[model samples]
Target: MVTPAGTLALLHTSPVHVPVFDGLRDRYHPGLVLRHLVDEELLRRARSSGSDAVAGPVAAALAAAVADGADAVLCTCSTIGGTAERQAGALGVPVLRVDRPMAAEAARYRRVVVVAALRSTLEPTVSLIAEESGPEPSFVSTVVVEGAWELFEAGDRDGYLDAVAASVDRAPLSEDSVVVLAQASMADAVERMSTRRPVLASPRLGLAAAAEAVAASAAVRAGRD
Candidate 1:
Protein backbone atom coordinates (compact mmCIF):
# COMPACT_ATOMS: atom_id res chain seq x y z
CA MET A 1 0.00 0.00 0.00
CA VAL A 2 1.41 3.36 -0.95
CA THR A 3 0.87 5.72 1.94
CA PRO A 4 -0.75 8.88 0.60
CA ALA A 5 0.63 12.33 1.44
CA GLY A 6 -1.04 15.74 1.80
CA THR A 7 -0.09 19.03 3.41
CA LEU A 8 -2.29 21.40 5.36
CA ALA A 9 -0.46 24.68 4.73
CA LEU A 10 -2.21 26.31 7.61
CA LEU A 11 -1.90 30.11 7.45
CA HIS A 12 -1.94 29.90 11.19
CA THR A 13 -2.55 33.47 12.35
CA SER A 14 -3.36 32.28 15.85
CA PRO A 15 -2.99 29.17 18.03
CA VAL A 16 -6.60 28.07 17.50
CA HIS A 17 -6.02 26.41 14.10
CA VAL A 18 -3.47 24.04 15.66
CA PRO A 19 -6.18 22.10 17.51
CA VAL A 20 -8.46 22.23 14.50
CA PHE A 21 -5.92 20.52 12.27
CA ASP A 22 -5.06 18.11 15.08
CA GLY A 23 -8.73 17.11 15.22
CA LEU A 24 -8.69 16.56 11.47
CA ARG A 25 -5.53 14.44 11.60
CA ASP A 26 -7.01 12.37 14.42
CA ARG A 27 -10.27 11.79 12.55
CA TYR A 28 -8.83 11.18 9.07
CA HIS A 29 -5.82 9.05 10.05
CA PRO A 30 -3.39 7.48 7.56
CA GLY A 31 -5.86 7.65 4.71
CA LEU A 32 -5.37 11.42 4.54
CA VAL A 33 -1.77 12.62 4.85
CA LEU A 34 -1.56 15.95 6.66
CA ARG A 35 0.76 18.60 8.11
CA HIS A 36 0.65 22.34 8.90
CA LEU A 37 2.85 25.39 8.18
CA VAL A 38 2.50 28.48 10.27
CA ASP A 39 3.05 32.12 9.21
CA GLU A 40 1.91 34.07 12.23
CA GLU A 41 2.84 37.65 11.35
CA LEU A 42 1.30 37.51 7.90
CA LEU A 43 -1.99 36.39 9.35
CA ARG A 44 -2.04 39.15 11.96
CA ARG A 45 -1.32 41.82 9.39
CA ALA A 46 -3.89 40.42 6.97
CA ARG A 47 -6.51 40.33 9.70
CA SER A 48 -5.79 43.96 10.40
CA SER A 49 -6.99 44.95 6.90
CA GLY A 50 -3.60 44.61 5.37
CA SER A 51 -3.89 44.02 1.65
CA ASP A 52 -2.81 41.00 -0.36
CA ALA A 53 0.69 42.29 0.38
CA VAL A 54 0.84 39.84 3.25
CA ALA A 55 -1.03 37.12 1.41
CA GLY A 56 1.50 37.24 -1.41
CA PRO A 57 4.29 36.04 0.87
CA VAL A 58 2.09 33.40 2.44
CA ALA A 59 1.03 32.14 -1.00
CA ALA A 60 4.64 32.04 -2.10
CA ALA A 61 5.45 29.93 0.96
CA LEU A 62 2.56 27.59 0.16
CA ALA A 63 3.62 27.42 -3.45
CA ALA A 64 7.01 26.28 -2.26
CA ALA A 65 5.41 23.54 -0.16
CA VAL A 66 3.49 22.29 -3.19
CA ALA A 67 6.74 22.32 -5.10
CA ASP A 68 8.24 20.31 -2.26
CA GLY A 69 5.78 17.40 -2.86
CA ALA A 70 2.61 18.26 -1.00
CA ASP A 71 -0.16 16.65 -3.03
CA ALA A 72 -2.80 19.06 -1.78
CA VAL A 73 -3.01 22.27 0.24
CA LEU A 74 -5.56 23.12 2.91
CA CYS A 75 -5.60 26.65 4.30
CA THR A 76 -7.13 26.81 7.77
CA CYS A 77 -7.08 30.50 8.40
CA SER A 78 -10.20 32.58 7.71
CA THR A 79 -8.66 35.94 7.03
CA ILE A 80 -6.57 36.19 3.87
CA GLY A 81 -8.34 33.02 2.73
CA GLY A 82 -9.00 34.29 -0.77
CA THR A 83 -5.33 33.72 -1.39
CA ALA A 84 -5.88 29.96 -1.31
CA GLU A 85 -7.87 29.84 -4.51
CA ARG A 86 -5.34 32.00 -6.28
CA GLN A 87 -2.52 29.82 -4.98
CA ALA A 88 -4.38 26.69 -6.05
CA GLY A 89 -4.59 27.94 -9.59
CA ALA A 90 -0.94 28.89 -9.57
CA LEU A 91 0.16 25.55 -8.09
CA GLY A 92 -2.08 23.43 -10.35
CA VAL A 93 -3.25 21.38 -7.33
CA PRO A 94 -6.20 21.16 -5.02
CA VAL A 95 -6.20 24.08 -2.58
CA LEU A 96 -9.12 24.53 -0.23
CA ARG A 97 -9.94 27.40 2.08
CA VAL A 98 -11.59 26.68 5.44
CA ASP A 99 -14.61 28.88 4.77
CA ARG A 100 -15.75 27.30 1.50
CA PRO A 101 -17.83 24.48 2.98
CA MET A 102 -19.50 26.38 5.79
CA ALA A 103 -20.14 29.25 3.41
CA ALA A 104 -21.98 26.93 1.07
CA GLU A 105 -24.04 25.58 3.97
CA ALA A 106 -24.75 28.95 5.53
CA ALA A 107 -26.09 30.29 2.25
CA ARG A 108 -29.02 27.87 2.38
CA TYR A 109 -30.59 29.84 5.19
CA ARG A 110 -32.36 33.20 4.85
CA ARG A 111 -30.34 34.87 7.57
CA VAL A 112 -26.90 34.05 8.92
CA VAL A 113 -24.65 35.16 11.72
CA VAL A 114 -20.90 34.65 11.28
CA VAL A 115 -18.79 34.38 14.39
CA ALA A 116 -15.39 35.24 12.94
CA ALA A 117 -12.34 35.50 15.14
CA LEU A 118 -11.32 38.66 13.34
CA ARG A 119 -12.99 41.49 11.40
CA SER A 120 -11.15 40.58 8.21
CA THR A 121 -12.64 37.07 8.10
CA LEU A 122 -16.27 38.14 8.45
CA GLU A 123 -17.01 39.89 5.13
CA PRO A 124 -15.06 37.58 2.90
CA THR A 125 -16.60 34.47 4.42
CA VAL A 126 -20.12 35.86 4.30
CA SER A 127 -19.68 37.09 0.75
CA LEU A 128 -18.30 33.84 -0.53
CA ILE A 129 -21.09 31.82 1.06
CA ALA A 130 -23.62 34.30 -0.28
CA GLU A 131 -22.28 33.97 -3.80
CA GLU A 132 -22.74 30.21 -3.62
CA SER A 133 -26.22 30.17 -2.05
CA GLY A 134 -27.67 32.76 -4.54
CA PRO A 135 -30.39 34.47 -2.50
CA GLU A 136 -27.69 36.33 -0.52
CA PRO A 137 -28.59 35.88 3.12
CA SER A 138 -28.57 38.68 5.63
CA PHE A 139 -25.24 38.87 7.41
CA VAL A 140 -24.04 39.90 10.86
CA SER A 141 -20.57 39.94 12.41
CA THR A 142 -19.15 40.30 15.92
CA VAL A 143 -15.60 40.45 17.23
CA VAL A 144 -14.66 38.73 20.40
CA VAL A 145 -12.40 40.39 22.93
CA GLU A 146 -9.59 42.39 21.35
CA GLY A 147 -6.96 40.50 23.31
CA ALA A 148 -8.42 37.07 22.66
CA TRP A 149 -5.09 36.05 21.18
CA GLU A 150 -3.33 36.94 24.40
CA LEU A 151 -5.78 34.78 26.32
CA PHE A 152 -5.14 31.94 23.94
CA GLU A 153 -1.36 32.25 24.30
CA ALA A 154 -1.77 32.20 28.04
CA GLY A 155 -3.28 28.69 27.69
CA ASP A 156 -6.63 29.93 28.79
CA ARG A 157 -8.91 27.60 26.87
CA ASP A 158 -11.91 28.45 28.98
CA GLY A 159 -11.29 32.16 28.58
CA TYR A 160 -10.94 31.81 24.84
CA LEU A 161 -14.20 29.89 24.52
CA ASP A 162 -16.00 32.21 26.88
CA ALA A 163 -15.00 35.30 24.96
CA VAL A 164 -15.85 33.80 21.59
CA ALA A 165 -19.12 32.30 22.72
CA ALA A 166 -20.15 35.48 24.42
CA SER A 167 -19.48 37.57 21.34
CA VAL A 168 -21.38 35.11 19.15
CA ASP A 169 -24.34 34.82 21.53
CA ARG A 170 -24.72 38.58 21.57
CA ALA A 171 -24.69 39.06 17.81
CA PRO A 172 -28.04 40.10 16.29
CA LEU A 173 -28.86 36.93 14.43
CA SER A 174 -32.11 36.55 12.58
CA GLU A 175 -35.13 34.76 14.02
CA ASP A 176 -34.67 32.07 11.39
CA SER A 177 -30.92 32.02 11.30
CA VAL A 178 -27.82 29.93 10.63
CA VAL A 179 -24.40 30.43 12.18
CA VAL A 180 -20.97 29.72 10.78
CA LEU A 181 -17.54 29.83 12.36
CA ALA A 182 -15.41 32.08 10.16
CA GLN A 183 -12.14 30.53 11.29
CA ALA A 184 -11.19 26.84 11.58
CA SER A 185 -10.06 27.20 15.17
CA MET A 186 -13.57 28.09 16.24
CA ALA A 187 -14.99 24.60 15.55
CA ASP A 188 -15.14 23.48 19.15
CA ALA A 189 -17.03 26.55 20.17
CA VAL A 190 -19.39 26.10 17.23
CA GLU A 191 -20.38 22.71 18.60
CA ARG A 192 -20.67 23.95 22.16
CA MET A 193 -22.75 26.98 21.10
CA SER A 194 -25.04 25.23 18.64
CA THR A 195 -28.06 26.27 20.64
CA ARG A 196 -31.28 27.60 19.03
CA ARG A 197 -29.54 27.40 15.63
CA PRO A 198 -27.20 25.45 13.45
CA VAL A 199 -23.46 26.09 13.88
CA LEU A 200 -20.96 25.10 11.21
CA ALA A 201 -17.18 24.88 11.32
CA SER A 202 -14.91 25.65 8.36
CA PRO A 203 -11.86 23.55 9.28
CA ARG A 204 -13.89 20.36 9.53
CA LEU A 205 -15.48 20.96 6.17
CA GLY A 206 -12.27 22.12 4.47
CA LEU A 207 -10.23 19.20 5.82
CA ALA A 208 -12.77 16.60 4.69
CA ALA A 209 -12.97 18.19 1.27
CA ALA A 210 -9.18 18.42 1.05
CA ALA A 211 -8.78 14.76 2.08
CA GLU A 212 -11.07 13.71 -0.75
CA ALA A 213 -9.30 15.95 -3.24
CA VAL A 214 -5.92 14.56 -2.27
CA ALA A 215 -7.21 10.98 -2.45
CA ALA A 216 -8.63 11.58 -5.92
CA SER A 217 -5.44 13.21 -7.11
CA ALA A 218 -3.37 10.31 -5.82
CA ALA A 219 -5.63 7.79 -7.50
CA VAL A 220 -5.36 9.59 -10.80
CA ARG A 221 -1.59 9.84 -10.53
CA ALA A 222 -1.31 6.13 -9.80
CA GLY A 223 -3.50 5.22 -12.77
CA ARG A 224 -1.39 7.30 -15.14
CA ASP A 225 1.88 5.84 -13.85
Candidate 2:
Protein backbone atom coordinates (compact mmCIF):
# COMPACT_ATOMS: atom_id res chain seq x y z
CA MET A 1 0.00 0.00 0.00
CA VAL A 2 1.22 3.50 -0.72
CA THR A 3 2.00 5.66 2.29
CA PRO A 4 -0.30 8.66 2.32
CA ALA A 5 1.10 12.15 2.36
CA GLY A 6 0.65 13.87 5.70
CA THR A 7 -1.56 16.90 6.22
CA LEU A 8 -0.03 20.39 6.28
CA ALA A 9 -1.65 23.47 7.77
CA LEU A 10 -0.93 27.02 6.78
CA LEU A 11 -1.41 29.93 9.16
CA HIS A 12 -1.90 33.24 7.43
CA THR A 13 -2.26 36.85 8.53
CA SER A 14 -4.37 37.66 5.51
CA PRO A 15 -6.95 35.67 3.56
CA VAL A 16 -5.20 36.29 0.26
CA HIS A 17 -2.56 33.66 1.03
CA VAL A 18 -5.16 30.91 1.04
CA PRO A 19 -5.42 30.69 -2.74
CA VAL A 20 -1.72 31.22 -3.30
CA PHE A 21 -0.53 28.31 -1.19
CA ASP A 22 -3.40 26.17 -2.37
CA GLY A 23 -2.27 26.75 -5.92
CA LEU A 24 1.24 25.79 -4.96
CA ARG A 25 0.07 22.57 -3.33
CA ASP A 26 -1.90 21.71 -6.42
CA ARG A 27 1.09 22.38 -8.61
CA TYR A 28 3.77 20.55 -6.65
CA HIS A 29 2.42 18.40 -3.86
CA PRO A 30 -0.81 17.14 -5.35
CA GLY A 31 -1.28 14.44 -2.78
CA LEU A 32 -0.57 16.54 0.29
CA VAL A 33 -3.60 17.43 2.38
CA LEU A 34 -3.75 21.09 3.33
CA ARG A 35 -5.61 23.14 5.96
CA HIS A 36 -5.57 26.92 6.00
CA LEU A 37 -6.19 29.12 9.02
CA VAL A 38 -6.21 32.89 8.86
CA ASP A 39 -6.06 35.41 11.67
CA GLU A 40 -5.89 38.94 10.37
CA GLU A 41 -5.97 40.22 13.92
CA LEU A 42 -2.69 38.48 14.87
CA LEU A 43 -0.81 40.55 12.32
CA ARG A 44 -2.78 43.64 13.21
CA ARG A 45 -1.86 43.34 16.87
CA ALA A 46 1.77 42.54 16.10
CA ARG A 47 2.04 45.59 13.87
CA SER A 48 0.54 47.85 16.53
CA SER A 49 1.81 46.52 19.86
CA GLY A 50 4.69 44.26 18.75
CA SER A 51 5.31 40.60 17.81
CA ASP A 52 5.20 39.60 21.47
CA ALA A 53 1.58 40.64 21.57
CA VAL A 54 0.70 37.71 19.33
CA ALA A 55 3.15 35.13 20.63
CA GLY A 56 0.58 33.34 22.74
CA PRO A 57 -1.98 33.39 19.98
CA VAL A 58 0.51 32.10 17.45
CA ALA A 59 1.31 29.19 19.75
CA ALA A 60 -2.36 28.46 20.27
CA ALA A 61 -2.91 28.47 16.53
CA LEU A 62 -0.05 26.05 15.98
CA ALA A 63 -1.31 23.72 18.69
CA ALA A 64 -4.82 23.89 17.32
CA ALA A 65 -3.57 23.05 13.85
CA VAL A 66 -1.65 20.05 15.19
CA ALA A 67 -4.62 18.87 17.20
CA ASP A 68 -6.74 19.25 14.11
CA GLY A 69 -4.48 16.70 12.27
CA ALA A 70 -1.80 18.84 10.70
CA ASP A 71 1.51 16.99 10.59
CA ALA A 72 3.25 20.31 9.88
CA VAL A 73 2.27 23.95 10.21
CA LEU A 74 3.54 26.75 7.99
CA CYS A 75 3.22 30.29 9.26
CA THR A 76 2.76 32.76 6.42
CA CYS A 77 2.86 36.03 8.29
CA SER A 78 6.35 37.53 8.11
CA THR A 79 5.63 39.89 11.04
CA ILE A 80 5.02 37.19 13.65
CA GLY A 81 6.62 34.24 11.87
CA GLY A 82 9.65 34.15 14.17
CA THR A 83 7.50 33.86 17.28
CA ALA A 84 5.55 31.05 15.68
CA GLU A 85 8.64 29.05 14.69
CA ARG A 86 10.04 29.34 18.21
CA GLN A 87 7.02 27.31 19.37
CA ALA A 88 8.08 24.35 17.22
CA GLY A 89 9.81 22.51 20.06
CA ALA A 90 6.73 22.83 22.24
CA LEU A 91 4.45 21.75 19.44
CA GLY A 92 6.68 18.70 18.68
CA VAL A 93 6.02 19.20 15.02
CA PRO A 94 7.49 21.07 12.09
CA VAL A 95 6.33 24.63 12.53
CA LEU A 96 7.99 26.67 9.86
CA ARG A 97 8.08 30.27 8.73
CA VAL A 98 7.41 30.71 5.05
CA ASP A 99 10.36 33.04 4.56
CA ARG A 100 12.87 30.57 5.97
CA PRO A 101 13.74 28.74 2.78
CA MET A 102 14.03 31.97 0.87
CA ALA A 103 16.13 33.40 3.67
CA ALA A 104 18.49 30.45 3.58
CA GLU A 105 19.00 30.94 -0.14
CA ALA A 106 19.33 34.71 0.16
CA ALA A 107 21.93 34.37 2.91
CA ARG A 108 24.36 32.66 0.54
CA TYR A 109 25.26 35.84 -1.27
CA ARG A 110 27.60 38.66 -0.24
CA ARG A 111 24.79 41.17 -0.60
CA VAL A 112 21.03 40.87 -0.36
CA VAL A 113 18.14 43.24 -0.92
CA VAL A 114 14.99 42.44 1.03
CA VAL A 115 11.78 44.01 -0.18
CA ALA A 116 8.57 44.25 1.78
CA ALA A 117 5.37 46.24 1.59
CA LEU A 118 5.09 46.86 5.33
CA ARG A 119 7.54 48.09 7.93
CA SER A 120 6.25 45.35 10.25
CA THR A 121 7.46 42.65 7.83
CA LEU A 122 10.87 44.15 7.15
CA GLU A 123 12.51 43.58 10.55
CA PRO A 124 11.40 39.99 10.99
CA THR A 125 12.52 39.10 7.46
CA VAL A 126 15.91 40.69 7.97
CA SER A 127 16.31 38.80 11.24
CA LEU A 128 15.43 35.50 9.63
CA ILE A 129 17.83 36.07 6.74
CA ALA A 130 20.52 37.15 9.18
CA GLU A 131 20.10 33.98 11.23
CA GLU A 132 20.43 31.94 8.06
CA SER A 133 23.51 33.89 7.05
CA GLY A 134 25.38 33.20 10.29
CA PRO A 135 27.74 35.66 12.05
CA GLU A 136 29.58 36.77 8.94
CA PRO A 137 26.49 36.88 6.77
CA SER A 138 25.98 39.11 3.79
CA PHE A 139 25.30 42.82 3.81
CA VAL A 140 21.53 42.97 3.60
CA SER A 141 19.61 46.08 2.60
CA THR A 142 15.85 46.60 2.83
CA VAL A 143 13.33 48.28 0.57
CA VAL A 144 9.79 49.13 1.57
CA VAL A 145 7.25 49.18 -1.21
CA GLU A 146 5.73 52.44 -0.09
CA GLY A 147 1.97 52.84 -0.60
CA ALA A 148 1.74 49.15 -1.52
CA TRP A 149 0.17 47.86 1.69
CA GLU A 150 -2.63 50.33 1.39
CA LEU A 151 -3.28 49.05 -2.09
CA PHE A 152 -3.31 45.46 -0.82
CA GLU A 153 -5.60 46.35 2.08
CA ALA A 154 -7.84 48.18 -0.36
CA GLY A 155 -8.02 44.94 -2.47
CA ASP A 156 -6.00 46.40 -5.31
CA ARG A 157 -3.85 43.29 -5.76
CA ASP A 158 -2.71 44.19 -9.26
CA GLY A 159 -1.64 47.62 -8.11
CA TYR A 160 0.05 46.18 -5.05
CA LEU A 161 2.06 43.71 -7.18
CA ASP A 162 2.98 46.44 -9.61
CA ALA A 163 4.24 48.61 -6.78
CA VAL A 164 6.34 45.78 -5.38
CA ALA A 165 7.80 45.11 -8.82
CA ALA A 166 8.51 48.78 -9.25
CA SER A 167 10.38 48.92 -5.96
CA VAL A 168 12.68 46.09 -7.09
CA ASP A 169 13.47 48.01 -10.23
CA ARG A 170 14.29 51.09 -8.14
CA ALA A 171 16.36 49.20 -5.56
CA PRO A 172 20.13 49.78 -5.50
CA LEU A 173 21.22 46.28 -6.42
CA SER A 174 24.71 45.24 -7.43
CA GLU A 175 25.15 42.39 -9.91
CA ASP A 176 25.83 39.95 -7.06
CA SER A 177 23.02 40.97 -4.71
CA VAL A 178 20.13 38.55 -4.47
CA VAL A 179 16.71 40.13 -3.90
CA VAL A 180 14.32 38.65 -1.38
CA LEU A 181 10.63 39.45 -1.44
CA ALA A 182 9.61 39.45 2.23
CA GLN A 183 6.01 38.27 1.90
CA ALA A 184 4.34 35.40 0.08
CA SER A 185 2.03 37.89 -1.62
CA MET A 186 5.04 39.45 -3.25
CA ALA A 187 5.99 36.30 -5.19
CA ASP A 188 4.39 37.39 -8.42
CA ALA A 189 6.39 40.57 -8.30
CA VAL A 190 9.41 38.57 -9.42
CA GLU A 191 7.85 37.92 -12.80
CA ARG A 192 6.96 41.55 -13.00
CA MET A 193 10.50 42.71 -12.36
CA SER A 194 12.43 44.20 -15.24
CA THR A 195 15.84 43.88 -13.56
CA ARG A 196 17.84 40.77 -14.35
CA ARG A 197 18.61 39.84 -10.79
CA PRO A 198 17.85 36.74 -8.75
CA VAL A 199 14.71 37.35 -6.67
CA LEU A 200 13.50 35.01 -3.96
CA ALA A 201 9.99 34.74 -2.59
CA SER A 202 8.36 32.56 0.06
CA PRO A 203 5.28 30.81 -1.34
CA ARG A 204 6.62 28.12 -3.66
CA LEU A 205 9.93 27.76 -1.85
CA GLY A 206 8.27 27.60 1.57
CA LEU A 207 5.59 25.16 0.48
CA ALA A 208 8.20 22.87 -1.03
CA ALA A 209 10.07 22.84 2.26
CA ALA A 210 6.86 22.21 4.18
CA ALA A 211 6.05 19.31 1.87
CA GLU A 212 9.50 17.84 2.42
CA ALA A 213 9.00 18.20 6.16
CA VAL A 214 5.66 16.43 5.99
CA ALA A 215 7.20 13.63 3.99
CA ALA A 216 10.06 13.29 6.43
CA SER A 217 7.75 13.23 9.44
CA ALA A 218 5.52 10.70 7.77
CA ALA A 219 8.45 8.43 7.02
CA VAL A 220 9.40 8.50 10.67
CA ARG A 221 5.88 7.65 11.77
CA ALA A 222 5.73 4.83 9.29
CA GLY A 223 9.03 3.52 10.55
CA ARG A 224 7.75 3.44 14.12
CA ASP A 225 4.74 1.42 13.06
| Top candidate, metric TM-score | 2
**Worst 10 contiguous positions by lDDT, candidate 1:** 1-10
lDDT of 1 by residue, 1-225 (tens): 233654445556666577667766676645565656777787767756564777678778788878776777777777777776677777877887778887887777777777765667777786787677775555545454466556766888787777777767776666778777776766677545646777778776777777777777767666878
Candidate 1 wrong stretches, greater than 4 Å: 1-9, 135-150, 153-155, 172-175
Q: What would the TM-score be for candidate 1 when compared with the true structure?
A: 0.85
Model 2: weakest 10-residue lDDT segment is 1-10
TM-score for predicted model 2 compared with the true structure: 0.95
Each candidate's TM vs. the true structure? 0.85, 0.95
Every candidate's lDDT: 0.70, 0.89
